[model samples]
Target chain A: MRLSLLSDLNEERAARRAAVLVTEVGSGEQRLVREGQVGSDPLAKDLEDSLRQGKSRLAEQDGLQFFLTVQTPPVRVVVIGAVHISQALAPMAKGIDLDVTIIDPRTAFATPERFPDVPVLAEWPDTALPDVGIDPYTAVVALTHDPKIDDPALMAALRSKCFYIGALGSRKTHERRVQRLMASGFTEADLARIHAPIGLDIGAVSPAEIALSILAEIIASLRNERRRSA
Target chain B: MRSTDTDILKAAEAWRREGRGVAIATVVETWGSAPRPVGSHLVIDEDTNFLGSVSGGCVEGAVITEALDVIADGKPRMIEFGVADETAWQVGLSCGGRIKIYVERVD
Candidate 1:
């Protein structure tokens, strides 16, 4: 690899942006396709597929073979409460390599001792969420069950491209929450993005079981989104 | 950073900077029962040091051998292995799967 190309690749990595390194098999010629520049590339479809799936592969276009090396930012999960469910969910998310963060204003609950090594933001979601910078790869889950806290976080999530937004609540609670969101100027389409009564229906009874279901649902949503986009 | 491909690429880059010959082999495609996914990589330095896996022990030895040749010749080769083929058992792809790998020098 040329020094210039290596430096360019490093720049993309530093910026937390996605890119594809295309290497021609026969000639070893290389080019970097930054996420923003993929639209005009000749192998746009292949590059986009690699980005969406976060996988690299060899692609042949008109008999010209090229290796597409995919580089994606890490997936993130931001839990809105440092509750018992989060105690189970945080490590579970980490087990799957999702960067996890716990957010709550309650200092006693949101402690490093409770959620060791995981990022715990002791600020309100309205303040902390923006700093966290949710992106397309982020999964936002609201477990606080407190309207003041979860609602603002949900609003932030809805505005951004976070792939998954789930809230823990009963059907009745979600309906009432819906009325509040509607009154606050949220459209049906926006509200639909929230996975109310969050997590997969596995008849989960304990906090750990519920956490497992949430992670499963998040994974399913991610895979389904990729399939739909593909 | 969690991705093996990224780690392999970084190792290859470092090895190259250290003036060591380096080559990378990547799984380009796979068929039935392939253990490793496409895009999996195994990087080889001139000293035979390797990082990552292409087939979960099914084909790393073969890939490293081919990669050494690629490092010397600077030519990329696409190789295919499968369990259904006559040489499948010999090559150790006995998991009823096939994989296409592209090996190349990272120049």
Candidate 2:
């Protein structure tokens, strides 16, 4: 690997962009393919598949063996509340290599003492999320249970390509929330993308367990062959 | 702190920039119950200092030794280890899995 290539790869990773390193195993030849430039590559089909799956693998092209190192942007979880669930979820998510950020307008709840070692933004989601930069690789969890706080975040998530959008609430609460979002002009299909009554039905009775369930659901959404959609 | 692939790559770049010879060993293929997944990296400096793993703790010694040679030769080579190989008994993957690693020097 050339230093220039390695530096470019690190730059892509730092910028949260996807890139692939293609190495011709036999000849020691290599090339870097950025995410947007994969379409014109000779191995476009295989590159697309590998990038989508975010897995590196060996490929044979024209009797030449090549190794494709797929480098996907890190998966990020943006928790809309810094409550007990976010406290639990943040650490657990970090343990699994998921980048977590907590956003809450409530200063007391968003204090660093409550959530250590995680990025806590004591700002409103509408103001904070843009700087956080929600992308296809991000998962948004509305855990505030406050319409003022959670609603704006959900709207931001819905408008973006985030992989998972989960809201902490009951079915009835979600129904009311849906009505509010509908009145705000979100289609039924668009609202369907939000996983309400959030988390898997794991019979979670405590904040930590609920956080585990939400993390599990986020992983399921992330690892699905196709991106979860309405 | 845990050394993720990002950290490993960043270390490799930093090490090379600091005028040290560095080689990166990557798991290119695996069969059976491989300890580490494909694309796992182990970056080795000239002095045998290494971070990350291609086969958990198994086969790292051999990979690092080969990585040193790659740094000397400026050539990339693919090495394989498995339960079936006699070297596996010496290096001991013990996990009953096969893995192919590619070691390349950063020029």
> Over all chains combined, what TM-score does candidate 2 have?
0.92
* Interface Cα root-mean-square deviation for all models: 3.3, 1.2
Q: Give each prediction's DockQ, rounded to 2 decimals.
A: 0.48, 0.70
**For model 1, what is the C-alpha lDDT against the true structure?**
0.86
Highest lDDT: give the candidate number.
2
Q: lDDT by residue for model 1 over B1-107, one digit each (tens)?
A: 33445656767777788888888788888989998988788888888999988887978888888888988988888888897666668879978899988887766
Q: Which portions of model 2 show Cα errors greater than 4 Å?
A: A226-230
Worst 10 residues of 2 chain A by lDDT: A221-230
lDDT comparing candidate 2 with the true structure: 0.94
Candidate 2 collision pairs: none
List TM-scores for all candidates, in order.
0.87, 0.92
| TM-score of chain B, candidates 1 onward in order | 0.92, 0.97
- In model 1, what lDDT does residue A123 have? 88
lDDT tens string, model 1, A24-123?
8777788999999999999999998879877777789989988887888767899999999999998888777677999999898899999986999998
